[model samples]
Target chain A: MEPDVLLSVRDLRIAFDGVEAVRGVSFDVRPREVLAVVGESGAGKSLTARALLGMVPAGATTGGTIRPDLSDRRGRRIALVPQDALSALSPVHPVGDQLAAAVRSVARVSRKEARARAVAALERVGIPDAARKARAYPHEYSGGMRQRAVIAMATVNEPDIVVADEPTTALDEEHRDQVLRVLGERREAVGAALVLVTHDMDVVREHADRMLVMYAGRLTELGPADEVLARPRAPYTAGLLASLPEHAPRRRRLPALPGTPPAPGALPPGCAFAPRCSLAADACHATEPEPQQVAGRLVACHRWADTPDLLQEAYRASS
Target chain B: MPLLDVRDLVVRYGTVTAVDRVSFSLEAGETLALNGPSGCGKSSTALAVLQLRRPDGGEVHFEGQELTSLTDRELRPLRPRMQPVFQDPYGSLNPRHRIRDAVAEPLRVQGRRPTPGEVAELLDRVGLDPSYGDRRPHELSGGQCQRAGIARALASGPRLLVLDEPVSALDPSVRAGVLNLLADLQDDLGLGYLFICHDRAVVRHFADRVVEMREGRVISGWRRP
Candidate 1:
């Protein structure tokens, strides 16, 4: 791992009842970088984020090393901005009290000092009247306000890395933008690297510096966000981009991925995506492709070079 | 004639006005998407048009018949002309009822006894296996439950379908499939759609025309560019 890498996950595997949900996933997050893990549901994006914090689900066995370089932290240097803020927060307590507890956990601070820090953190996330708002319970806050509070709580101690799982999935367009803005601003303020797990490609395109595409519990593509979006090296990545309705011309049917994601531990033999891939050939069916260095990125595909022009043309026509 | 029409619709709860002077019309085989943020009165507009909630003011017309003026007894006969599919299929569908009975209930409400084959065909039309009719809502996935909901909605042979974020609860891949199914249904049956959604990308693809709402008012309406 590079010296600047804040988090390095290697060969991570999660399984339930002998069924592998996240199989052999690996990635790195550099300091101050926003690494987006994009995939449709059941692709194990959420599980990978959980494994980063050692919070796997019940009945799941995990295998792999998630190395977070947080030597400076006295307690936990990693924080999580969960997808559902309401569930993550204490419903009965005022948000300020909950936030102060988070601060107290990381440092030897007094109750007064922690409360002040909590208000400041809320303000940092763009919540107005932070002191008064902090006194409000989770339900008193709007969806956007609750998410902001969650971001504030997660980053209150200035953690080195923040893992956000589908943070904007519940909000409307306006509120979603607000949450994303606050998340970006807070990350910049704390200089913390972010591991964003989301299925919304538009969010990844807009906020991510690096993109990691997971499919069937494995990494299919990892590269600079722009490069990956411009020309996906993996068929799964290409198919995901094509399926976006934003990429379709008005009145034109979207190019949809024909089938659902394979069930966990029930993936077909050989390439997991070969069954749905349009570029599948004889070689693709016989063996699972390993991640190989191609076009300055890591791509898992045997026939990646053959379909670049086709993807480019399709993207151009739609845009 | 337009399949559904609303003019100067207003809905208020207590001191707060939920929808303010929202107006739109849907022709047969057309889709009009109500796009906006949450708390923008999208649901209120739909409810007022359906007579599920009485509007504070406005006119709701269905094929030249005034729906706003109709009482529960008067509107009972016309209920089959407009049906709703809500966002959460699980919540919208009865948990204890078998899928077959759920689909057949709408037809039964309209004084028609549906055969087993008819219920099976309804399920099949929504892209579900006919055999799924025997199972309950919990036995199915979110997508499957949504398909069953759509199947039930169609059992009434409604000319207008009011879908309130119907595919929002499903995964992205499954969402696309359900969306495609909806489009296919509209095309084949010439059904008009009033699609309420927060997803702009979906609205762009699925709606023939789009109306943007904010602060309980229609801000803009135009043909898709």
Candidate 2:
């Protein structure tokens, strides 16, 4: 029955002191699925990912039941491939030893076995001279190589879920492609769920099966990656999709949603996006918009159902 | 005139050559993007141009002056002419310092006392509210903090802005805002930009010319559409 969702998080909320950073956010990630969490800075996508792994930073505190369905797996519930590769990799430790240590730390594996597995993982990620490169410190490896090293560590344990939080953010396009290719291959080796939290629509479109849109501290929309992108419902989601440079209208003023995103501490009571949302009404300001089924997508907006294909029409009509 | 010119630029950290024979020029009022994989020396090249890091060899001519040979005291006057906006805004600015002080530092460093009126104008240009001036780095969002960094870069009236992975650290959505702001600022002030990044999409969309680097070398020269 639908392979029993690997991680089912509901009504998740994270806060810094009393101010909400992730307010009543929820989503499900299935086995062998890459659910892309797409949002702008301060949209709470990272906080949500951190919540799942129980790895929020010192100042942040969370409220959520991250019930990982790892009964069928042999390793940790989650492994994180952080955005900064150089900082993520220990400068003093050799890349190979670090990766091998990760695999062994997850469970019971002989040091020799883990080292061999580390080499295999490195090879799988397309690192040339895997065995030799393993002994090199972080300073010796290039940016792209270091990123691959991090990915190899995360997947070496064959964890149930991998939280790739902006894993390709620092690398150039070519290196980004290489890292993504490695992650795709690793998914085949270990039937793990991947939650790729990023802001790049191109990345989510290329690699993810499903997508969740976040604004301020709450979820705005959720649906298939392509489907939601093709027909975004929430006004904030529509605005973000339209604002991507590739999707912009030539020689025309961009369809910019005016007003800066609200500070997490000073967010409006009902809808966090009401300030910049053109379609926002009084109802949006009076009460919170719970997730409602609109055109087979879960959208958290009061008037989204009525605006069927409005975003698509707007994008099409722009040019 | 090229706002900034570089030829055979090389920077070394002990025995390791971080940048090797890197050369590209940002034309006056034109954007030139430098794209390459990490450790390709894009950021190092930018820093050396600012003389934040002295190059072991090469020429960095800004506004028709060779910056490489200038001493710290000699370079003081030219420092405001080419300012750097770092990849990480968090690391670039002091955490305890208010946004106003951070943005105003360049002006203050140049021996000009910054008034609230001038700081407000700077904030307005970068799309940050003047109200945010009192807040520290921790109070600002990644995008906002970055815009504040840009304000700092612009405060001293630099003719050429060297943005080293400026928006790469920002979210995709916030990137558009920063880019559009840069474009608008360029149009208004006719300021030249050396947009150093790895994302070809960003380079293609924002820059007038493209330069690619590989292993600290300029593998491809400038190309314009």
By lDDT, the best candidate is 1
Deviation from native of the Cα of residue B145 in model 2, angstroms: 3.6
Give the TM-scores of the predictions, in the order they appear. 0.93, 0.86
**The candidate that achieves the highest TM-score relative to the unseen native structure:** 1
Which lDDT tens digits does candidate 1 get at residues B28-56?
99999999988889989998988999999
True contacts kept of 2: 0.32
TM-score of 1: 0.93
- Candidate 1 is graded, for docking, as medium
Task: Put down candidate 2 lDDT per residue, A1-319, tens digits, no spaces.
Answer: 4466878988898888888889998788888888999887788898888677777778877686767634344335578888888888889899899888888777688999989999998887888999999888889987778888888888887777888999977776776777787777656766677889987777888888899998888889999998888878787887877766666543233455566677789878788888777777899898889988887878999878554454565567665
Model 2, B1-225: lDDT tens per residue? 677889899999899888998877777778888888877888888888889889999999998889899899999988888888888978898999999999999998888999999999999999999999999998887888999999999999989999998987776557777888888888889889988888766776777888888878888865664
Shift in Å, residue A252, candidate 1 = 1.2
lDDT of 1 at A188: 74
